[model samples]
Target: MRDRFTPLLAAWLRLLEPACVRCRLPADSGLCPACVDALRAFPLPAAAADDPAPVRAGLCWSPACAPLLRRYKFHGDLAAGAALARLVLPELRQAARPELLIPVPLHPARLRRRGHDQALELARLWGRELGLPVAAEALRRVFDSRPQTRLSAAQRRRNLQGAFVARAGLPSSIALVDDVLSTGSTVRAAAAALRTAGVDGIQVWVLARAPGRPTARLGSGHEQVLHEHATEQSGTHRLIGFEGTKAVGGMA
Candidate 1:
């Protein structure tokens, strides 16, 4: 019977799998302990005291974490995506639960080129772990928009104004999943469309959050900085000191 041979099949497959892509270690998990530990060292703050956006991330985006996501996103690497999903599972367990999972939809053109939607891939992984439904086709991108990475927050908002359209009725609450949050324009637009269709509560869940909000103008305030510290310097942005001490004044 297939059940009788399941364990044997698993063992045989493990033997043929490649080493951890990041460390070249013999790991069937797609990542070794060392790389995972390095990622944990930079997990995002559990919760920002004054942040109102219901966004949550496992790690802050960094040069080290970039390759893992880029490989999964651009190079069509499934192993990298699963490893990153495993890293995010713990944080999702610690957060408030949601009724359903919805991935930010991709334009059909982009979807054809990539061959898969990265957000949908991540949503499926998390949904399996949490016993939630993944509504991959519940919302659709109505039109293609410019890449958001280079745009200011305001510009991003404008670009996505009508990018997403709901394909069906939404539930009262759902978690919107994505691989990363930069200016957050895409998620915001998706949420707005969902809300207009009667979904009242929305939670934005992502694997990572890129550092800084869309940059502000010259001589402007340091709103882009996630951390605020009052140190012995005039124009430097430092994270809150260890244990969140090194007291700084004013709000971020």
Candidate 2:
């Protein structure tokens, strides 16, 4: 009798659910199956040949996925955050696994405003899925820097400098987990801190890689800009271009 009503219960739940965030179609989940397929089908850009840190990402950042991240990161949508983790899991499973997962820490002030740390949330979700332990306290943000979204690459670097400090007794090899990778300033600084704490290996993982362009001259021997080039195809912009990176990686 219970099994007989299971389908009906599921159907009723679907009716009461909200529409898919991306397509505005009725969906039990915030994201529909079709949108998930589209996200999986998006072509990933080639890794930067000169990138020092091994990086893995689930999707390329675009207008299509930006709102999902914004909702999760800024608006405190745990469901949206779970959707993103599901999307990124496959890519992370393919990469080199670390002894532990460490999220880029949030300053106390920002944590108060946000109510939850996005990176910590991602790390916990991933830790449970991947069967790894999360060292949430391994790293701490010593400074409460301004937001990095509107800042240039140089400014981003300056803003995040000395922002992270790692605690002792961290694993020799651990992956730094975050929501997105853009200019990479944040992760580079974080990785540097871990190095200072005597960690030997670091892997960077993120849900998406945002498009960026090198503002500094390529001839200056500075970090080259990695950006996604948009090509209009079939009424949608195809995200194709260089994988964005700096000296390392971070979410902007």
Candidate 3:
């Protein structure tokens, strides 16, 4: 197989070479040097909510991190997922050898339409790189709801209510993987489901947070919007998904 495919793979690489895997900015060997530092610099634990459960991330949801995730999630860019996974592996390690690395599951309809699960792709790459077991099926999405992107904060919470279920519970410590966390309602809902299944320690791992949205330092204009919406709510956990059962509303 290697002999037969090597030439074709070589041709593809030669044809597609030198595009920065993240921003496609003249690849300086996979990721540019600036992206290298961006990927590795800063302490992720410091940025998370000061809960006992340690949560870590790769980059703040800034302009630097958006392009890559958009490319991978919306444009079907699988390589970007692997590249981003390499960026987040260090933080994943901080969670300490979790019994299972689970990617947030998508509904079957969306998964089929998208032709991929971006989080699952990242989790698989992460598990491979770190030699940890990736449980793509550990948690199942019971609700086939609308995309959280379009819903308001309240609707997001209600939409996701009882949306997840765990088939086989694992250790107290479990790492959940997602591409981006805007309001964190999704992760918290998923975590709540996991908690119901008996897992105690849950840490979320994401590629980016809403820039300057309290949880992370991404430099998007949305930060002001997030801050404004956040003031209305009171709690350590910020609402990433829309609140209220109403279909349309404001976001944080």
Model 1 agreement with the true structure over 134-160: per-residue lDDT tens digits: 998888898878665456678978988
Report the C-alpha displacement of residue 204, candidate 1, in angstroms: 1.1
- The TM-scores, one per candidate, come to 0.74, 0.75, 0.72
lDDT of 2 at 217: 23
lDDT of 3 by residue, 61-123 (tens): 654555666656654556555567666667667766777788999887666655567788777
Best by lDDT: 2
Q: Could you tell me how far off, in angstroms, the CA of residue 217 lies in candidate 2 after the best superposition? A: 17
Indicate the residue-level lDDT of 41 in model 3. Answer: 62
Better of 1 and 2 by lDDT: 2
Q: Write the per-residue lDDT of candidate 2 for residues 99-141, one digit (tens) a residue.
A: 9999988888777665567798889889998999999999999
Q: Which model scores highest in TM-score? A: 2
